[model samples]
Target: MVFEDLGIMPAILEALKGEGYINPTPIQEKAIPILIKGKDLQGCAQTGTGKTAAFAIPILQRLSQNPLQKQGPKPIRTLILTPTRELAIQIGESFASYGKNVNINHTVIFGGVSQGAQVDALRRGVDIVIATPGRLIDLNNQGLVALNKIEIFVLDEADRMLDMGFVNDVKKIIKLIPKHRQSIFFSATMPDSITQLASSILTQPQYVEVTPVSSTAETIAQELYFVDMVNKRDLLLHILKDKELKSILVFTRTKHGADKVVKLLERESIKAAAIHGNKSQNARQKALNDFKDKKLRVLVATDIAARGIDIDELELVINYEIPNIPETYVHRIGRTGRAGQIGKAISFCDSDERIYMRDILKLTKINIPVANEHPFLPAEGNTDLSTAVKPKAKAPLPRENRPRNHAYGSTSKGGNGQRKRENSF
Candidate 1:
């Protein structure tokens, strides 16, 4: 349905028009009306589903309708808690963009940087505050933030926050808010823990499930390359060299791996950047901004750092290393194929990652095509086909001594020796 039919105000409608958002997404269509009614909500939709606007628009409209009159730097009236710094910033941007024509003051806070600026912003008074859990707790503990006046509380990406071990922090933050306030919980998936948490926080809330749990977007072309670990980087470089690949997102399992991948790509004179927890906030943001502007051809990111990357027309997502958690596979691929646009997700799987691939297929109930003939795969005679045979389960190696079969070489070994070990192990 058109956004106008949803009863959004003239200013908001104008803002939407300027932003070229004429219609609402499925999640937005269902959740916006329910949210505007001032009822608690439990939203089930993946990232890039326009879920941010679903809540942002309603919240902004509600706040505008009932402007706070508190004198000294109006205390925070609405609080939004997100899982990662990047997501928190993106949500704040959504609020700013939608509320540009309306009169609303919002600020975002997160760690990985100094707190002086965030503290100063809070002191100046903001109507809405978007923050990561850790930084939010820190500010609250330091008496810089006041949640007693909160009218609406949002827990965005609740499942990811829980996965990042923020349940205790979330519980503590909830206790600080008034029990009478409206609470909203949005997530991509609904595991038992998140479901139980939602049940406890929401009181007869309007339930919205635009997409099924553990499902990937239908527009993405999913494929898996059965390649030896040693060749994954070379294969990635080859794909990046293609003139058709305008922009690409690459996912690695760890921050070090992401950095190493970026370094290797740079060594090949390919413009790339890496973002993860270890990077400074400015660095992460710069990389993200560059990638979005097409100033950088590739961006390698870890799972946690890649949240809230709302790039339209992202054509490719390369899984440099398969995620152990099946649900993460869905999230990684969701970065591409956004807004009904066709995209491609290419996953690199070694002999040991077959089980991980199987688990992801079982969870999503979709069998990705096996692409064994990709340039990333070894020559026919070079591959050890015996590794694929059953009845000979390989024994697990010690974690420290385990082969570094990642997208880039690790410190455990260097040069061609590591490649030899990777092929033989």
Candidate 2:
């Protein structure tokens, strides 16, 4: 449905139209009205679902309707906590973009850069603040910012925050804010911990869930390449050589791996960048900007680095390393196929990662088609796909080494059909 149908202000609707957002995403459609009603909400939707706008629009409209009372320098009326600096910046941009026509002042704060600029912004007084948890805590502790006057509190990417070990920090921040304020928590996955956290914070909140946990977008075409780990880089290089790959996001399991992947690609004369926890905020932002501008061919990132990458027309996502957590597989592939656009997710799985691949399939309930014709595959030399051997099963240990006693105090008899002692000790 259109944004205007949600009862958004005419000015806000005009701003959305100017920004080319004519219709609301499913999450936005379900959330905007409830949010405008000034109620707490718990939203479960995957990334790239326009969740930022869902809350931003309603918040701007609400704040514009009831202007904050001026008491000395105005404290932040709205606080939005995100897991990463990139997401904080993105959410801030969304607020600024959608609230441009409206009379809302917003600022974003995160670490890895000078606090002087952020301090300046806070000094000037902003109506809304989007920030990373650590930086928010730091600014609060320094007495540069206060949350006591906050009217609305948002925890975006709640699962990612929990994954990054921000639960305690989140709790601390929540305690600092006014208890009576409206709270909204949005996450792609709702594990038990997230559920418990939400229950503790929200009071009779409206629950909006558009997708199941650990489920990948249906528009994505998933495929797997059974390649040797050593040849993964070569396979990636070959894929990048294709002219069809417009903008690619390559996911590595570790920060070091991301850096190495970027270095390798650069050595091959491919323009690429890496973003992770180790990189300074400036470097990460520059990389992201370059990738968005299409000046960079690829962006290699760890899961954390890629947490809030919302790029439209992202043509592909390559799993340089399969994630151990099945849910992470869904998040990684979600980098592409965003905003209802068709995309491709290609995974490079070696023999050791076959089990990981299976777990991902079971979680997402989508069988990724296996491709044995990739250049990295041993059978690629022969066009006959039948010659490719299936992955071999791991050999079992010797019989003597096997555990003799069962948990039920029973043991398998030998050829003599005799019972063994329950305990070998």
Candidate 3:
């Protein structure tokens, strides 16, 4: 159904149209009505499902209808708490886009960057505050943010927050806010812990779920490779020989692993970048922007970035390192194959990682076609990693070794019009 049918006002409808948003996503169709009616909502949906607009639009409408009429600093009426700074910034962008006609002021607060700008924004007074758990609590403790007047509270990506060990902070925030506030809770998965958290905050909440994390989209073709750990990098380089695989998203399990992938690809003259927890905020954002603009063809990232990356036409995702968590595999591949676009996910499973792959397949309930003839295929017959039958894996042509200490201060591109990794975040 269209946004018009979901009770959105003309001004907000015009704003949505400006963003080229046409039909409502399923979550928007189901949750928007309930939220607009001032009801608590529990939404269990994964990223790329357009869940942000489901609540953003209605809140914009509600705030516009009853504009705050105070002359002093504007009390924050809405608070959106997300797990990562990227997600919080993206949510802020959504609010700015959807609330263009609503005349509301909002600021995003997160760590890793200096708090000078954030503190200034908070002191200047904002109608809405979208923040991460740590930065929000820090500001609250410093007496810069008072949430007692929050009317609409949003606990987004609840599961991720808890996974990041933000449960106590979340509880503290909840206790500070008025209990009568309208709460909107959403998680990609509904584990028992997430359910308990939702129950604590939501009052008779309407439930709507879509795109559960365990299921992969049918449009994505999953390919598996049996390469040993040392040869996994070689398998990645071998796969990159295909010129058709443009704009690839590579996932690694550790921050150092992501950096290593970027270094290997850069030495091959293959443009790449890495984003993880340790990278400076500017570096991570710049790398992500470069990838999105198609200046960079490949982006290597950790699971912290698994969610909240909403790139259009992203079609290839390579898992250089499979995650132990089965659900993360879903989130990783879900980055591609979005908007019904045909996507491909290539996973390299070493003998040690076969158990992880097995759990992923079992969770998704789909058989991934394995590639047995790859150059890096373990020399031994392809067998379950649990079994002690393995041979050597192959690699591509040799590359001279080079030392890496620091080089995140260049933004120049060369070699086949590919954007080189000037700064490996």
Model 3 per-residue lDDT tens digits across residues 1-425: 78899899998898677545778888899999999998999999765577888888888888778887769887889999988765665576567657766677688777766677777777777778888888788889899888988999999989988877898989999998999989999998899999999999999999999864588999999999888787887788888999987799999866668888999999999999988655654687799899999889999997664445677899799998877668779888988888889999999887767777887888899988988777877866665644633222321111111122321211111122322121100
TM-score of each: 0.65, 0.63, 0.67
- TM-score of decoy 2: 0.63
Which segments of model 1 are wrong by more than 4 Å? Answer: 190-192, 213-222, 226-233, 240-345, 348-360, 369-425
Highest lDDT against the true fold, candidate? 3
Of 1 and 2, the candidate ranking higher by TM-score: 1
Ranking by TM-score: 3, 1, 2
lDDT of each: 0.77, 0.76, 0.78
Q: Which stretches of candidate 3 lie above 4 Å from their native place?
A: 211-221, 226-234, 243-344, 348-359, 370-425
Candidate 3 achieves a global lDDT of 0.78
Cα deviation at 192, candidate 3, in Å, is 4.5
lDDT of 2 by residue, 277-344 (tens): 55655677799999999999899987655655688889999998887557778877887888889999
lDDT tens digits, residue span 63-142, model 1:
98998666667788899988776566556656655776777777777776667778877887788888888878988888
Q: By lDDT, highest first, what's the ranking?
A: 3, 1, 2
Model 3 earns a TM-score of 0.67
